[model samples]
Target: MKPFTDGDFIKTVIIQAATRWFPGEDNRRDFMNIVQNTRLSPATITRKVNVMADHVHEQLNIDLKKCVRFSIHLDESTDKTDTAQLVVMIRFVLENGSVQEELLELIPLTRKTTGLDVYLSKKNSILAHEVPLEKLVAVTTDDAPSMTGKITGFSGQCLRDPDFPRFLSFHCIITPRSILWENFKYKNRV
Candidate 1:
């Protein structure tokens, strides 16, 4: 048997990092060097980080299940790694009537990003989280043609779906409303 419990030692490292109690990587290496016996490999640390991230992801899905009506906010941007990525977030009314926004996932686009591709990626992520089509109250995306173009766009494709809520499939308003309102007021004043 090992002299020390690996699980406990690894958890201690996770806790320190979580609480921002981590001193420095060099400090940790120096300490481990001094200990010699309990020194964990770099690979082992990486594995533990992946394990914790998976646990957090599972918990987020569980939390998302509690909200009935949710609006998906989709944005496309390059990640730190310079890979094209899509970021998905959700805003929902909680049980207490407070709105909560949670970042759901990041999806890397391995190929060309078309309207169909964005729509499918969003659909897959939502389905994987077990958020039903009925509960998807809205989809908010940027004004980019791939997302909002009147034809062959993500919003247009959604509108074609019989299951899609006709009233909510259109993206959350981000523009034009103010312009229209101003025009109306100006005409009325004149």
Candidate 2:
């Protein structure tokens, strides 16, 4: 039997499954097992997935620019390699009443988290490539003092000036799990 190599079909199935199933970290290995059992080389499957992701990103970029109102969600996480990275995700409502979210960029934090200036500079540089700073409607982030300070400083310096455009910034409070559970229980009882 010849090796079954249909990149497009495999890619479509993988993408659909990933999007629909919402597979967690452990489920990913099971997903890979299924793919491997298909008689397709792992490399071929990997390449196909990369191609699909690239295509999705290209379409998303075009769609995002045409959107008038959108929201920016910024979060930071540690990758498997133990590198601290900032992930910028954009949420937009299309003209057809459909909501679309795309991962805009992942920026590695080179310096220590204490260095607000360095982090701000890197964030600005990364964001400038995706969308104009002036066009941002609102920014959502956690209640980190450094992050809040940077946003205030940046907005004041760049957007508040007479020559620049003004934008809105919203901070979302993130608390510990115990506090969150208590709040959730209180809200439920109310």
Candidate 3:
């Protein structure tokens, strides 16, 4: 029997269901069992998903061209496969005063994830998307050593760049407000 690999609706449905429930498994049998036998081979589903991702990525690049200013939040963490992945998210203000936040990319660190590694990955992503560096206003990252180390960290490299905009680099504080208050009180004797 031939696969029902026609129409945009089927592709959309497959993409939605795959993203919703599959999470990790992209097995044809798993999808067929749960998604009512769409008869799509694993290869077809993978191709459709890749095309959709490319479309979204292109749309984001276009939207970025409309931004008056943008800030990026980056976090690096080890995935289930023990690979270091950098999650880059962008928050930008459009010319019409509307704000938007989006996941720019998830980059895998194939080698040592040093400050240079993180910085290069982010720089490549921004350059590939053709986002103007002058429009970048800030960056936020967790207080990891590779992120906060002024002399050797990602922010340091950006700061050293002459063409790069003078952007604020802030450490994102994720602790509870109550705990922070207690710490402040103890430190300041207030």
Q: Give me the candidate number with maximum lDDT.
A: 3
For model 1, how does the per-residue alpha-carbon lDDT over 1-190 read when each residue is reduced to its tens digit? 3533365567566655543444677766655544555546666656777899899888777767777677888777767887778888888876678788888888898777788888788878878988756777778886667788667888887778676676465554454555799889999994
Task: Compose the digit string of candidate 3's lDDT tens values, residues 1-190.
Answer: 2343454466567767676555666575466455564545657767888899999988889889989999999888889999999989999999999999999999998898889989999999999988878999999987677887787888988899786889999987563554889888999983
TM-scores for all candidates? 0.64, 0.58, 0.70
What is the Cα root-mean-square deviation between model 2 and the actual structure? 10.5
lDDT of each: 0.73, 0.62, 0.83
Cα lDDT of model 2 by residue, 66-157, tens digit? 67667676665568987777667777776787877777777786665433543475357445545544455666655555445544433334
Clash statistics: count for each candidate: 0, 0, 0
Candidate 2 residues lying further than 4 Å off, grouped into runs, are 1-39, 79-82, 114-129, 150-164, 175-190
State the number of backbone clashes in model 2: 0
Pick by TM-score: 1 or 3, better one: 3
Q: Give the better candidate number (1 or 3) by lDDT.
A: 3
Tell me the TM-score of model 2: 0.58
Displacement of residue 180 (Cα, Å) in model 2 is 6.3
Error of 3 at 94 (Å): 1.0
